[model samples]
Target: MKQVCLAILTALLALTVVSPASAQYIWLDKNNVKVYSDKAPPPDIPNNRVLKGPRGYKAKNIEVKYTDGTEPPAPEAKAASAPGTPKPPMTTAEKNAEFNKRRMEQAEKEKKAAQEEKNRQAKAENCERARAYHRALQTGQRISRTNASGGKDYMGDEERARETSKVEETLRECN
Candidate 1:
């Protein structure tokens, strides 16, 4: 008995769910314009204008024939392309390729700009070093160095001239 009662309850719930799917309603608005919906019309609508739609009616591609014998206008067609020269629109893959190409180009430009900035900083540092060396050369301080044999070697006039020329070359190249 309990199994039978459970089966009856399940059947009742299924019917309630399926009944609304097959039901449709039609009504006229305040301006007498025809409206179709799945739900019942509101209380403000007159009983005469409220109608029961066709059984199991799906709304897609369904045309409404007015009571006054007038049919709605047909949908407009798409514009035609020129003969023999028509180009199809770009596909999703083509659009994505174009976007990636632009993105890569932008990344390359940014990398080049960073490299140029680094080069500029290096040049500035070299220029400062050359200027400092030139200033020391002009100071006329006795310049000497310890040789590999631990003997003190003083720079002669010819050695001084060579060193000055090298410093000048560095200044010109960096500046």
Candidate 2:
């Protein structure tokens, strides 16, 4: 029995030591949402920032490897320090034209961003309003159906109409 126990222990130890760990990379998508996976992105995707997995299985142990794909030649000290570039002088008219162009571009970008935000908010609000309307309808139907007594003990037709109108107002606000 002791020999069998020893063999079992040995087998467990071997299993523990035999399996090696692997690493994985993680990054955010276009929507600024985080994603993690074992595979690398394809070449067509811009910014080939590879997240190098550690020698272990856990993602937390992964290291960020910024391999910019392009090969860099050996650097020379003299070429780096040389400030041979000259800035071109701009006339007042040219400067004003450039400023106006940049202002228009910035305004256009802001407008598009605002429109996208508005659309997202409208969608969320519409969903909420629709859900509320559905719930009210369901509740009203349940109240009306279950109370099948000949006497009018539940909400009258006028009250039901008011409730429906309120829900419609909420939906209109979403639009």
Please report, as a residue range, the 10-residue window in candidate 1 with the lowest summed lDDT.
75-84
Clashing pairs in model 1?
A: none
Native-vs-model 1 lDDT?
0.76
Model 2 scores what on Cα lDDT? Answer: 0.63
lDDT of 1 by residue, 1-175 (tens): 9999999999999999998786478877655567878776666555666666666643333445789887755432221432433355589999999999999999999999999999999999988988987887778877888999999998887888899999998887874
Q: How well does candidate 1 match the true structure in TM-score terms? A: 0.45
- lDDT score, candidate 2, position 4: 100
lDDT of 2 by residue, 82-155 (tens): 57522446899999999999999999999999999999988897869677765877575633434556664666
Compared with the true structure, all predictions reach lDDT values of 0.76, 0.63
Task: Name the runs in model 2 displaced over 4 angstroms.
Answer: 1-84, 137-175
